[model samples]
Target: MRQMAVIAPVAMVMVGGLSGCDAAQPTDSRFAPDYQGVETTLLDGDLVKFDVAMQGARGPVDVENYAECAAAQYALIRGYGFARHLRTNVYEEAGLWRGDAVYTISPALPRGVRTIDAEVVTASCVENGIPMV
Candidate 1:
């Protein structure tokens, strides 16, 4: 009787554990997107540029600057998952950071990942070349 009681609890625990693990598995294609690529165009003829717009916690990027420009570059390249044979020059203007990055995105990305999350790094807080505040 004592051995039976111990085995019953152990068996129940094992069953519960198995059930939990099964629920943790990923779902089918309903949640996945069929990825292809994104569209690219020229801002200036042969200046070698592509324009990408992504939402940030603050607002649209000011690509005319430098640091935020770099961060934006990192975000787009990683977020869109573009191929090689591409490079870039990032810039900002009117408080919007832009990446004139050199890459050939398709007409549109099939994966359907809309937003690229990028941390805003800026030089505006510089005092003697050190970031303040």
Candidate 2:
């Protein structure tokens, strides 16, 4: 009976600990992002350059994502179904973030690991409230 009593308390404590582990972490609700715009330049056939700017970005990743979303939408507008990521340069100055990215648009899946389906990426961008041009 004494062992049973001790085991009951221990089991209760373990269950409480496990329940706490599943608790949701707090997120910052002050995250307000402003997407400036995107400027696209055609370097050559199938090769395109995207310049994107934004404000209130959390980090370089946000700027890069803006450029990526632009590339994906551009590919779709050009009647291409796929875009291959080439490179992206991200920088922040004062309170503004900018990304200079290059991508290759193709009718079919391009020859690269960093490839994106235009339709899928554009859908995700729209769902995430990201602007594209």
Candidate 3:
């Protein structure tokens, strides 16, 4: 009976502690203005959507241009190599030559990591004969 009383309190405490933890806290992947390599162009910028797995927890994001969008994705993957968390394969569709770039990011991210900002190095389209976007 005495042991039961002690065990009850201990179990309650453990449960309480776990409930307080934010194992399921929502993550924000929205990027702020002034992001590197972000710009507006003729195509009006590419669209970025989170993969099915990444939809809720990690959130979704959109980019206006393909060059910056693709580079940002590349930088994000390369950046994650430093942290060594779970990874998602990102690939590009045919868009650059047409003055746009489309990419797919997937597999959701674990808790803790929220937004990833990647610098855009190449501007594939421009008014004066193909400047970077």
Model number with the top lDDT: 2
lDDT by residue for model 2 over 18-49, one digit each (tens)? 98886687887686799999999999999999
- Tell me the TM-score of each prediction against the true structure: 0.26, 0.79, 0.24
Residue 85 of candidate 3: its Cα lDDT? 20
Off by over 4 Å in 1: 22-47, 52-99, 102-133
Please write out the lDDT profile of model 3 over residues 22-99, one tens digit for every residue: 887687756332223333222212224222111111111222233434434443443421111223333323321122
Give the C-alpha lDDT of model 2. 0.95
Residue 72 miss distance in model 2 (angstroms): 0.7
The local distance difference test score of each candidate is 0.36, 0.95, 0.34
Number of backbone-clashing residue pairs for each candidate, in the order shown: 21, 0, 6
Q: Tens digits of per-residue lDDT for model 1 on 18-110?
A: 877845657553412111122354434322244443222132222222223333343344443221224445443554334444533332332
Assess the local accuracy of residue 104 in candidate 2 as a C-alpha lDDT between 0 and 100. 98
